[model samples]
Target: MKFFKTSLLLFSTLLILFSCRTEEIQIIDPPIENELAANSTVAKLMKNTVAKDGSKDNIIDKASCLSVKLPVTVTVNSKEITVNDEDGYEEIEDIFDLFDNDVDAIVISYPIEVILSDYTVKTVNSDEELQRLAENCTGENEADDDIECLDFYYPLKASVFNANLELILTITIEDDEQMHKLIEDLEDYSAVTIEFPFKVILNGDTYVYINNMQELEEALEAAKNSCDEDDDNDYNDDDCDKCSTEGIKKIFANCNEWSVEKLYLNEEYLTEEFKMFTFSFRENGSIKIDNNGDISEGIWEITGEGNEMSFSINIPDYPAFNGTWYLHEVKEDSGEVSVHLLLEGNHLRFKSQCSTVKDGLNAILLAEGSIWAVESYKNTGEDETAVFADYQIYFYSENVVKAKKDGAVIEGVWESLNDGSMLALNFSDEPVNAFNKEWEVAVMSETEVVLEANDKRLVIKRIN
Candidate 1:
């Protein structure tokens, strides 16, 4: 019958070419390493309970760029909770309106904080934001006023391979909207993908598509050198010489009862029986302050070593139970058994006071179109956080204090001590790296503000 009807049309075109070569484009080699993520999407952003703060609801939005650290704690129903501003501040403001519609999921926690940059190609001289960024770029310019963009800065972190995730950052590139969606590119796809949620794997034929702009700047310099590294380690796979600083001084040198969760003085906050006092720390520095079980008599030291050390104590006559400290960075995947403190310039804060723990601090809504950003300053804490990241400090309700960068806005005169205990910031000609002087307001919020001089401690954060 015509060769059995052409052998049934050649076995149906060889079964549709073997189902199109078994559906090609594979790509998902996820897990990004360091600790196998636990294996992908950073193990759905970390857990074992209480999403460590990337969101178990401290709040997540601003387009899921993410924001956290407010005494965090989760597990809403099976018990175990905490979200402070005084115990579940109205359920953390109704869980920031219940995750404000989860802005397209980008949950980030762990030590994985981010802000790396190499981006700097500015260009676009504004004509209504270059007609909305030239409808997605068609570069090599000729018209579209030489389009360029990709400025930088503003929350975008999570790609921690080789494990160290405990990195704090501040890599502003400028004019952002997450650098206008990583320098868009019309149909010009060349792989940029950092719409962060975590996933990386470059060498063994690393995928996620890339071709030109020099393989999209070598896949953004191999995902910013696998998400930043200069020994600020934490993308995990163990053995960073066992998380160095001589393994965090042999894991905090030993014998530390600590127990004083938090107890600030002028920066106020001495919670529940004033954080049930109990301070012990001896590997020979000799110190003990147990107030409730009475133990007092301190004298400790350890000045500058890895990560620029500083943790002094004296308690003889007590100057707010002796000062000098720095080591508040919690989470190395935080599995408690803690010892956190921060005095130098932040006045005070000590944690490790269990019994159903607690933590919360995020203030500095000092007012008047507030805008601060001098994160860290203990002498030259990174050149006063790079001269206040090019200045921008303003606070007034007639307490006056102003300093903007990029255009004359100088004006400073702030005072606070009448039992508000020291906070003086003056400025006549200003430019004295330390932002004029006087401080002691440890923690403030509306999003962050810590300060302390003479032992230097200055952390200010609130960029608009």
Candidate 2:
């Protein structure tokens, strides 16, 4: 009695499982909406590529694969096989068949029809309606005669396979033109996954399939109407906290505080540019100062919280002026500075002069044939590298020099006086020192511009 009861229970369990699985695959009547329109090199020769019925048994063995059609709608090896878009396309690859002792040939053709089985999210322009479709996808069912569809969008990843059962192609799609072409040229019996709505190409042909057409059209329409909603403004994504509107506002505020204008300064204006400098603080703890072509320096400082910064420099042959400086003014793109110079023997108080900046290329005061000050060497205290002084000489754009005085900014088209790799400095107008010397560009970088003349190299630290 016990054995009979156990057998009966097992039979009942199997029947229940079978019924549940069958119920899951409901055969619905076929709908008529699923329809769509459609659309290299290498060597060697192989024989015996065709079977008895004149079909390509192995394309690799064919010396020349002929463009043949499905004669009488026959199947191959008892499997539903169809010629891919690559079927008629010839000369695809040339492989060496070692066993056959011949170079295997490859042929290509078009008109591939694939029975796709996977439903993937496709990336298209952001459309809420299509997004809803993607979220509601019921997936694919093989046993069901009827198919269900939705309006969804997501990123798509796709690949292609060859007769050898190896993945031979992979592509990505994000653009409409590319996606449209991809759906038009699929190989028969292939599959596609619409992961993200990007553009993709396969086997040198665009694919067009029935599965992607409706969603694609809907997604495109949604994208067209959803243009006003920018991703940058919607900082609600999990990773978008870093780009919050409040964070951006704070950055702009700092930029507003340290703004500086481009100006020219010289004997006409005894005061330095702006007379004060400013800096902007960023949420990421970084700072930015701006400059135009004339200024050539964009200095910034990144520091720990609540700590002062010590700006350093190496002035040739002279003792450095080390000090604590505070923010004087801030602007969107530039700033001014108030530096307290602390020297070993003297305390120097200086205010930078401000002037509207002119174009550097246009700021040229040419001395092509005119006499000017050339740099002469100077030795200060015990410094090994001797500083130079201003001397009188003539030059073209091909020569370089040095400036000695502290109260001067060279404004002329400077050049390498000697044959060497150096920056060319140009002046705004004909200054006394400019006529007196040929200034050599000492340092050149994105943020720092320095010129060495006389025994001194004037360093312009970009505070703006």
Task: Give TM-scores for every candidate, taking all chains together and pairing residue i with residue i.
Answer: 0.23, 0.17
Query: For candidate 1, lDDT tens digit of each residue in 380-425?
Result: 4344455556877776757777877789777877765422324678
Per-residue lDDT, model 2, residue 304, is: 20
Local distance difference test, per candidate? 0.40, 0.29
TM-score of 1: 0.23
Clashes of each: 21, 98
lDDT of 1: 0.40
What C-alpha lDDT, on a 0 to 100 scale, does residue 402 get in candidate 1? 80
> Which predicted model would earn the best TM-score?
1
TM-score (C-alpha, index-matched) for candidate 2: 0.17
Best candidate, lDDT: 1
Candidate 1, which ten residues in sequence have the lowest lDDT sum?
46-55
Kindly list the per-residue Cα lDDT of model 2 for residues 199-310, writing each as its tens digit. 3221111222224445544433333333221112111111222233343334343223443232212212322443344434345434433333222222333222222322
